[model samples]
Target: MTQHTPHLWSRLRYRFDILMAHGTPVLIGWLTAVCLAIVVPASVVLVGASRDVPTTAAGWGAAVWRSVGQTLRLGGEVGSPVYVMMSVLLALVALLFVSALVSLITTGLHHRLLALRSGRSPVLEERHTVLLGWTDQVFPVITELVAANADRRRATVAVFADRDKVGMETEITSRVGGTGATRVVCRSGSTTDPTLLSVVSPHTAKAVLVLPPEDPGGDAHVVKTLLALRATGPETRDCVVVAAVRDARNHPAAALAAGPHGHVLSVDDVVARLLVQTSRQPGLSLVHQELLDFAGDEFYVVPVPALTGRTFGEALGAFATSSVVGLRRDGGGMVLNPPSDTRVGPADRFVVITEDDGTAVLADTPPAVDEDAIVTARPRTQAAERLLLLGWNRRAPLIVEQLASYVPSGSTLDVVTLADAAAVRGACRPGRLDVRFLRGDTTDRGRLAELDVPSYDRVLVIGDRGHAVGPDAEPERAADDRTLVTLLHLRDIEQSAGRELFVITEMTDDRNRLLAPVREGADFIVSDRLVSLLMTQISENRHLAALYDELFAAEGSEVHLKPAADYVVTDRPVSFATVVESARRRHECAIGYRLHAGAATGPAHGVRINPDKREPVRFGDRDTVIVIAED
Candidate 1:
């Protein structure tokens, strides 16, 4: 009949906690009562042993009740007669009930205390990075944190998600390697709950990774988390918060919510951009992997101390181990494949890529051949190509058009898609791509082999719509699985047709690169990691992308794993000094390289790329080095 005060609910929760805490004790007490109810009476009826004897009602009553005091002597057998026996039973029951209650109470208290101690409790910590919704993104975010903190022995990442606490912990344990010094802890809570936000110590976390779930519900959750994290007050605020929106339409809302709180990434827009890039240039996805993987060679802003007054070309050769590929400064944008005269200045940061640690500049690699064999002429190929896309996606058509623009126009493309050929044709821009859609899945090896997959120089495996891999699918492993099977089938077809294939797949994850079973097979688009690196680089400077484009361009830029002998004037343990002079002579940038220490077959047989990297390089005829040379 009456409305309860707000305090009542709080009090009720507290009391309920207490009642639950004594659960063990309650059970013990009930069990003792039941025992006494049965055993006490049964012991009292000792006369039941001689049931045949006729007994008067009064006699029976006296035997059972009147002389009950005699039972006190039995108690005295152990202690103070009646008091001792009663005390024994009562004490045992009391102890059981008390112990059970205490245990239950203590366990709850411990959990509550633990939740508070960890940053999960909102009341204590504020402004820490508050990750809103959690999904696959959590894995990468955690992985990056591990890689980013490689210099440190330990790191801590607190996760807050809608998942159950046990489930969250278990999922993280299973997905992320269990044997890591860095600890990942999860709290069961919604992103919108500011109270739960405290438990993660959001006020202090270096950065928060907000991932939306796979479905629509996850989108709403991310949006709410963005807004809530942004609203934290100034003192406990300013922590970096990064979020992703599933739909492009949610971008503005997410951005507004993340305003000043941190940064927001629109996955759709980025995916579209990468698709356009991958379509134009094959193997750019592999480029993306080297860029995205923190452990592998990736883009970094190295201060070019020796090159304040030098050109990018001179500065590029200045670092013994690291290469100055591009420039980033106060006002200058990223200039990829910059002109030879691009000047390097103090404020200008050199975008150098390296692996494992800070860029370790190796001395220049020596010239493999003399000026006579060094072909200064560009290795120009036949104009354009006839590319056939075995699939369609947001990236497929773009990739076709890109190939057309980047490659010579005599190049024609006939698309093979399950989508409508007529509509695909109608939507097509004139002369860009000749649209011929076939209704079928590329996964079918037999059906796929029938198509001329090898005739074209390039074939892209685009996922079905809504299923396309994007920033989330880095190491585009699944895409590669589909692509690999298609490739294996195509490789067979190519073998049957007596032609070697140059295939490029657009995969989301770089990890899939190793999965392509076909030897020296196809170039893959590890877009996920590539996009990560691109975003990271761009965040530092917007120009890096253009420079990236040039370095990755098919006609203008190239990355070739060259044999060390290719750089040797003679076979000797060579100093990068000789290598540097030779690379500059060749008008090329020699970044880090792989070593084929052992083997007689294939490319860099048993090559070791990132080991004992500090040592000088020597080359045998069996080994090859990767060089970025202009065509």
Candidate 2:
């Protein structure tokens, strides 16, 4: 019997465990049962034992009601000592029951509040921009988006990332200060989770941007995020999804996941092309920056009925405040720097570079063209150049390939890095560029002297990605640190050689670009910031993706900085209109120019885009005109 009693006790404990597992409802039920057991027994004892209590049914009911009042802490009149004693015992049991009940309710409410604040709730926003994943790129993207939304009545940007909600908001607030009329909302979650992606309401968003993370597996996570968004709903397919990946190999998968309406960009391709292009032209990056950022002059497609039958060359002088770079056909094809005879249809729109939309207003009459100031001499013939590349990373091979496509044949490229020479040799397929690799540290002054840095026509420095990517932030800082050190060495070498080096430094962080020791007229390309700017531009208008594709392609009309002498006479002051007209004769479009004297100045960096055409500007012997032309 004793053993059976133990067994029975165990079974009873198991049943209690099951009951407790039922959560708040079951706990509340137990408390109610306890209250009843306390109140009913006390009432029965009071009705039967106390002589002051009546034995009638009505009396019993009154006693039970009094006991219930005592259990609930509501005072009731006591008739006798027995009744008073029963009431006191009921009060003690009631105290225990009330404490347990309050604790259970408090705990449940706390859990509910926590769940609500976990950023798991769905956003109730429509037509808002949704950005997934967090990186250094978020700040620039948010800033650009805010600028893009400046003219809107109301705008919202929802950011979803696997980070703390409050932290993201704080960082954005500090970095992108004062987003006027634009509301930025942040939610915390993983981009690869379908539920998390839905939390930002990507289906109803005006556009969705997927920012690749900073780790080695960032591209993989981006691919997963695209898949997750597709799994969210069918409506997401119709949404304008813009995604970017670090590796070009993952571009096809990302694009396929983004659907036909979506746009996919490769960071390596964009940055590599820009680096290769900017290495030749010093101030071209600043001009590209102005075109890419929203705070300054940018590309806008505006229809003008007045220029319906005008030729593409005549359209250059149609806008006084804007510079016409290209024309968009009715069939959605863009022809940048088209021939002088190319006519604009009634339905075609002009692609003008202006400060803002609607600001590309037409001029009543074209500005006076100084035909005598126009220089008709042909552009100087190209010559083979010697180039040197410092440091090596994942993008090094792409940069080399881009250089091969742009540089003339017989041009030699010497790559100096701490990495193995044979590995880089195997990766490079330099078609036109004569490639040479040397195993040495680029930061070492002795090795750089041996290579004769000043002997090269231009020097390109790329940050090492081997140490720039990892779970830790120190690696990225370390990579930037190495690049800065290399720049310092180059600066010292230039000082010793008494000759300026046309240095184009690739920086991982935008903040570190300011800390580099490069001399005046040097170019710094913050790779991630450029990627963010491109993503923001595409998010605002999907059609711009095709425009950018053509602009950045190797065999197209790209933005170039040619000698001002090639367009107009460099000996006298001339209006920008004259330069435009001169470029029109050569089948090119003149947008702006760079002053060799003010190249070291603040703000504009001597690069002016979309300047006042009627204002007469004097060009120095070394001044260059910014134009869109095919090589």
Candidate 3:
């Protein structure tokens, strides 16, 4: 009997499992039907057992109706004990059935809601920006997009990743605060999965950004995601796609995967180049940030038929507010800071620096040139520099290579790191630079003091990349902490010696940049944040890639912040048009000026770009003029 009972219960449990396997709606409906079946029959039996009910069929039907009414507390009265008992029994049975049914239905509905919150449902947005993959780079990209779309009536950015949708939303909200008019939506799914990619409605998207993951296998994941995006139908495949690749070796493969309409930015190479450039020029990073970010003056390409016959040099003075930088050829090519004699072709588009596209208009009359204030004498030659590079990372080698091109012959570069010196030497090419390496921990004050920090003309602090204890550990945080410690020591040593030292530090995250000790004269290169801004900018304007490439490369005309005294007399009020004329006399383009007294302050730190050309401004002897010239 016991064995038979176990078998019977097992069969019943199997049948119940099958019934529950049907989805939420079906399960709720089945529960409702089961409750009704039990309640109705039980009510009929109770009526038959009642004393006041008759035995005939008509009497039985009437009694059953009365029993149901009594169970529902609608028709019957509490008369005799037997009648009362029968009513109470039927009422209890109905209560039990209703309680079970409500519980089942509520449970089913809750589970269904949970499934929906998992981001499995498809989006119905059009002309939106779609972001694929999740990493530390996502927040900066979203923030930049929000600022870029601030003027729009409505803008939507949809994010897809293999993470919890609710969690992603919460983290982004906590980090970014209010998104203004831009709506940011997050979905949970693998970026490489085609079935899941459809949920973001790629066909309706206007642009797509693919961010590399934080793991070591980031390149593989990015390639797969790009491939998946390309596999989407022709409608989505034609949309503009921008991706970031960490390794330069993967550029060819990623570019191939991205096809003709896509732009692949090598993050390591870009950051390395920026670091080397900023090391020489203290405020160069801020200039790059202003050009890339939407909150400041950004690069804009617009067709100006009025200046079709003017020379590129003549067109520079045509804009009252916008600063003309270059021209875009008609057949989809870009030239930044072209030769002065280059004529503006009929089909060419002017690349001007302006607050917005609508404000990039040409002035009716060019500002008057001040020939007396212009200086035609060339600046003195650059002497050999004593450079000290502290710490090491993947970008260290590239920094050395780029630095070699800028530094003069007989310049000495000292690289100090805990890493093997031989390996560092092998990676660098011996140009005119006298390169040497020392193995030591940079965070130690004693070790730093031994290097004599104040003696070097420039100091660069590189964040450690090997601080992570495991594959999933947070390494950037630890590396930044170490960098902060090293900066504190360097600042103390410099203050004790009472001398000025130009310092440039590389940071992994933007939030930590504010926490560094030496904030005033120091420059910070937030690798990921800059990359994120560049990716977003290129995704919006593809021609910008070529413009920035020329700006960062060593062979072209680059932006430089020269002494204000080099252009005009100090403390004398002079119009910006006079400064422009002075720059032109020296075969250069003057964009703006920096106030030395206010260089350490907030906001723009006295770095003004694209000022009104007709306004007269007084410049101090120590102030610097922002210009573009061949060095």
Model 3 residue 364 lDDT?
80
| TM-score ranking of the models | 3, 2, 1
lDDT of candidates 1 onward, in order = 0.57, 0.86, 0.83
- The superposed Cα distance between candidate 1 and the true structure at residue 116, in angstroms, equals 8.0
Cα deviation in Å at residue 531, candidate 3?
Answer: 0.5
- Per-candidate Cα RMSD to the true structure, in Å, reads 10.5, 8.6, 7.6
The residue pairs found clashing in candidate 2 are none
Q: Write the per-residue lDDT of candidate 1 for residues 1-631, one digit (tens) a residue.
A: 9996678889999977876688897866876687657655864566455564327874554454422334422221233457656855775676678889999999999999876544355423432233456655566666765665567676666778767766777777787776366666667776787655655766676566677575545557778887666555442333566666655667788878776545666655555455545554433444455556555556666665656887866665555446555567657566544556777777887777666335545346422323432223235455666666766554454455445555555667766655666656654566644445566777787677677676666665654442332222322344456766766677677778887666656555456656665545244555444444444443333344456556544447555555555565435666544554455566666554544344324333343332232345666665554455674
- lDDT for each residue of candidate 3 in 1-631, tens digit (9 for 90 to 100): 4554458889999988988887799897997688668767998888767777686986776676666666555345346768867876777687778889999999999988898789888889998899999888999899999998999999999999999999999999998899999999989999998878989988788789999876768988999998888776663444678998877778899999888888888877888888888887878887777778888888888999998888988888888898888889989798877777888889999988899999998788887766667654446888999999987776677889999998989999998877766777887788999999877788999999998889899998988666321232336678799899999998899789988778999998888888888857468899889989999988777788888887878878788888888898665688898888777767788888888777788767778888999988888877889888888
Best by TM-score: 3
Higher-ranked by TM-score: 1 or 2? 2
> Taking the candidates one at a time, how many backbone clashes does each contain?
56, 0, 0
**How big is the positional error of residue 215 in model 3, measured in Å on the Cα after superposition?**
1.9
Best by lDDT: 2
